[model samples]
Target: MTAMPMTDAPAPASGSRPLTRVLIANRGEIALRVIRACRDLGLASVAVYTAADARSAYVELADDAYRLEGTGPQETFLSIPALLAIAHRAGADAVHPGYGYLAESGEFAAAVTAAGLTWVGPSESAITALGDKTGARAVAEAVGAPIARGSAGAVDGVEEALRIAEEIGFPVAVKAVHGGGGRGFRTAADARELPTAFEAASREAAAAFGRGECLIEQQIVAPRHIETQCLADAHGTVRVLSTRDCSLQRRNQKVVEEAPAPGLTAEQEQVLAEASASILSHVGYVGAATCEFLLGADGRLSFMEANARIQVEHTVTEEVTGVDLVAWQLRIAAGERLPEAFPAPRGHAFQFRINAEDPAGGFFPSTGTITACREPAGPGVRMDSGVTEGFHVGTDFDPMLAKLVVTGEDREAALARSRRALDEYRLEGVATLLPLHRALVDAPAFAGSGHTVHTRWLEEDFMPGWTASLTPAEQNGAAAPAEDVEVVVEVDGHRLTVCVPAALAAPPAPERRRSRRISRRGTTVAQDISGLTAPMQGTIVAVDVSPGDRVSAGDRLAVIEAMKMEQPLKAPQDAVVKSVAVAAGAGVRSGDMLIEFED
Candidate 1:
């Protein structure tokens, strides 16, 4: 492979007009994060939100806020037109697309530039080139970065995919060309599973990304998922930040990330860092980016893909490097050059994604209002959040409610801090990953043992002990007094002695019947709706009814955007639409009137 010729042009000089106003074209913790950075830099901050996120903390903290059309990601955050309009209306000089949504979208980047706004990210060309997995593989190979063995480009269909799978050997991975976050990905152990895996992956890819093209690659069993944070300037200067180990993952999404990977030999660390820098220079990459790689059991590192925007796990890298990546992104986009040399990372750090998910029940997504929230504090702890007590954790966007980050002098210290932080973190009104993370950090396997990404998910020994170690007091409510036991009870002639001390035997609280009330005095009730209420909070993406429209049971009424997933609210009974309460692009809360049915 021929090396791409390096351009000799010096980095662009910093813009004459410093950033005055910045608009965050994203939601959740990341949006709040950018707003805080703007505050530190003395720049005015603007937040754009869908109706679903109007109450988010980020919106309240911003200097100005705009309501975008549509409740879902596609209609709000990912809508290029909506974002540009917000930037223009807010008089924002720069637009920051936080990670996820359109953060890596080349089209959005170009649009921002065309609108004469600073795009606080990598160049559109670089994003487009590296966004496609197959194209990225080619680039990595060309730059002498190790790439996984696979088909040269996207496979045509099941037959082509099968052929590639066979050539790559059994246990291959079928991945979407435009996929991220582990969506549109599947693995097949052998030829028999190829067809099914291919069809499923293709359908998912088409639905998730509107792309059906896929590529086959050899699945690296027992591989550690590691990535290096890289920064570059327009002058072509690239520097490698500290490396992160994101091995604790579920369903291809990282749950915990730690910086300065543990158990790596000095030589291996240097090699990985250099390789990452080389690739960034080759691509003329600018802004903050992460180069993902799979460290195989044989100690060989294979480049996976390059994330063309700031990563969710970047906070961990920040704790170690003492560099604000988001700020650097803003500086780079404004044509400022990086420092002459990169500084070595200083301590160990870890970040845990606090998501509203139930680990006991298959990690199913949970959404509701956060009735109580108590964040961890003390030395070495930092919290980045989008919600507060009373803020609804609706189904309108990603389930991640906050990020808990900690830093320490070494890995053990970081681990201890993480454990303490998780123990102190309290959230109610919705299930969260706190319990799961606490259990994980306390486990013997995770305490000091080095494990890979695959090890956490596939290793048999690591699964059973997660919930087993919980004490009765921890599993239930607060501990009961020792004297509170010793009572005699008889059931079916069998006598049982139960002891309850005075301290523990408090009088039972009175139970009050919940009042069922519907308030419609001020608001007009739609007369023509016979559909089930939306099961979650979301933005209406597609409205299938209008006033006086007829519908049948099971008919699709509207598609709601929640947690980045689209769910259709269907008619529960046949009825005529007396009035449609919601229009496409409107946000709705659970039990919010959508359409009225004629009686």
Candidate 2:
């Protein structure tokens, strides 16, 4: 659709600004998500995009497009002033920050409030108190919700963290009080590792969220991750949608999420619902929010943290509860109350994140132009995707390309349907986790009522050994190396010989980089790293060492930011820094050099 010119209709002269026109301050599926919600409400929509996202599908779907000049999220989506200006330029009276980027930023919310634009999220005070884990734990405790035994609040320093860890016992998790998406979290098994992990987690939190405060929590061994979906209004009414199981994860990032969590008894479910309602009601929370909890296989639950915005896995809850959450968010922001009755969860729902990652290659990003694509459909299947053929997958944002949500009368039926749906999903040019997901749904461990899954279960039990048996061709789409020579000979009576062109073989080079893997022959395989190459594609955020500085085995060399995760490049062994190859803010590709070290 072509862009529509801005209309001059003024906002309603009322208590809260009515969402006549909404300016979307995010990109990808979520931008489309908010736009669709606006369509459902008969509200005009304005969409914004950075230069990189100019060709995005969501950009064209909006009634109006406000083009912003930038490439990365920092200069585009996360720029609050730019978003506010776009809201004004598009004559938008409301702004919706779809989950990532600046979704949980209290400053952004306050700024929107100051600008008199309807911010479709919780109040600034609620976000400030609940967005941080330490603050949320306190609020949960205040409402009589069960939280893990740990620190009173944000710990001051290593000294304070050490004290808390001592009281909580060993194997405690030091987390970024201001962090989300598991970015600035670390686990220390004992006192010897406490200070280092604490310092690292703090630095990462400061680098990512601009806040250095941290909290200590006792690690729940082999615990399932569960979350409750909730909605509150300008009034005091709070509705508990449903609960989800989000324990299938890698590096603390959830990969698969399901609603009406598997093993909880009726009593447990009631307890969860009551506790969530009490917490939100006490905090005076407004709009869509989620309360995360940690549960053991024995059915014990502990509230972990709270997200003040719609979560990535909200679709599964919607599929089960039959609630249009985003629409309710807009309605709630426009001063509407929840419906008198919510449909009790009718069926089981599952959402699998279709990420641009190579599962066999340690789940590293596999970004490029998507050559072809097809999403599953035809009954109980939903694909909330943002890309089509020729879409460029970049590292500037999150790697998830889409989500595949399927529902059935029960968990068994959902699993059966999910298997067929995974087989139907076909995409090329960019590697995906389809194969891994297919295996998971087909595995017996996930049969009947589904199985218990913990946070580390995927990485620990599934990923490592699963990939070893597959040939390189089966893992990556790469075909086997061509044979050295091809010969054609007639064996019947006539002798005829033809020699075809052939590839070469050589002695393998020594392993020196993160990408190198030992061949089956025990030969050291080189992975094309010239000198101190980058492990992944991202912009350099910091360069710590000089050309001639001596460094230890664990000294930090530099920091690279990709997909909101900060990857620190540390020296593998003691050496002198021969030369610094890249400067801060320079974008580097996988296997591109960042620093060279002299042995």
Candidate 3:
């Protein structure tokens, strides 16, 4: 297919001017990422945080910081008025919406411009055109980009959805017109499942994005999720970076990303890169953008959607290409043109999203204070994080704790480095995806082969005990099967000894008649003192109260250090500290009691 040329006019000449201050309109790793980029460019940075994030590392690292009211996205991060006020107050010359929470919102982009601040992203028109999946598909088709054979517009209801599903063939995917990140999407194998899938998808889309309009598309089975990273400038210069394989996902959210996807033929790579550049330029694209494509089993590529803002996996591209995308965004927004030609990617790289989520517990979100976060450091290892050892991991925001990126000579080297980095990583206060990532990198399929969107699902169904077996030593006790005999044990490090139950010389057998009754007594007793147990594996940072100190409920007793965050252990009820088993600087496990209190 012949590609059309981009028609956007060149950006005004502002590259010569130095950027003085930048405001990060987002949080977490991405926000910290922008701050670092600004620092490298010799520009001041301002971080806007909610009450929950006031203690975040990003706030402390930035040149200036301010608090936004409310704890949630709607009440703070997504509030345009609040963001504008912050930018004005901070005297920020530019605003970078790291990604998500209005990153792709055209209204937000326009508002930033209206407030006389540079929006470090694509043109608002381009964002609007590509933000809506339906509109994006139309643009792609108009520009001769390959698209799935399905509805050309939004499906009105279940009846319309059924018709489109039939036309598109069985196993159609219903996606929210304005959705990303896997929410508001459902797949149906046949007509029997269409009604339920449509209803569920619409409801989810509405609840998540406040938009119910959905479009049905033929589900591409065994499709590899590949995306092209492109950087464009106001001068109409566009460069297509390497492609990334983000096929390792769960529920549509990417968990692992690698650049220069393995197993791609020279021709296939050329086709994708050329098509991506064609589409972006044809739309007069500017700033940083990612054109996502679903590479089919047959080697044909189809348009999925175009992300108008910086992506989470952009780090993988940066590591391979040696390009600072955030810096380029700021320059482009300041009216800089891309170099005569973009630099070619040099090596293989990968990025793992380190999240505080329990893979064994169905990937449930885990929250707590980080006590001792030890990030990996070495050649090709880069840690982009918004947290330190004393920060709190709150439930009010996304569970992502940081991103671990590694670069190497080739895919195999990158894989090896990733494994080594994962080994070096340590988080104490809460469960994280570390175990799952370790299992994934070690799996035969992952180690020996590239990936597709369905890869994680296949592994999840087949590798039942993979992640369950690698539970952190802190979570190991929680995963232990019920025990009987009511034995009190003294545990130090990995060693354990039975200290209680002097009447019993050995642990009771599982099938013994008295085992069941003894189990109840043991459970009750354990529960009573469980509160005294260390909430996670960490070193004691402080002991606010000592033995014999009378304390009311919620009084701070001690602080634990894990994953670079501080967790304060508080008294559960009015009581006197009878004995302090641990002092400041002592290390503890999840079930180790640090203090004893008198009732």
In TM-score terms, which candidate is top?
2
The lowest-lDDT stretch of 10 consecutive residues in candidate 1 is 510-519
lDDT of 1: 0.75
C-alpha lDDT values of all predictions: 0.75, 0.79, 0.75
| Per-prediction TM-score | 0.79, 0.84, 0.77
lDDT of 3: 0.75
**How large is the C-alpha RMSD of every model relative to the true structure?**
10.7, 6.8, 13.2
* Residue range 1-599, candidate 2, lDDT tens digits: 33222232233224565567889888899899989988877788899987777788899989899888776777788899898998998888888999974789999999998998889898889898888987888888888888889988889999988888988898998999985877778889999999978877887788678888889999888888888999998777899989999988886888899988888888888878888888888778999999888886667889988888999999999999889999888888887767777898989999999998766655666678888787889899998998998898888888899999999998888888998898788777776777678767755555544585688788777675554224334444444333323243587877764333342213332111111232221111122222367767887877889988987765677877776666566666677888888998898888787788765
lDDT of 3 at 558: 75
| Candidate 3 stretches greater than 4 Å from native | 1-18, 449-465, 470-599
What candidate 2 gets wrong by more than 4 Å, as runs, is 1-14, 447-450, 468-526, 540-559, 568-590, 595-599
Ranking by lDDT: 2, 1, 3
- Model 1 lDDT per residue over 71-177, tens place: 55677777899889889988888888888748888888889988998888877888878888987998888878888889998899888988887777988988888
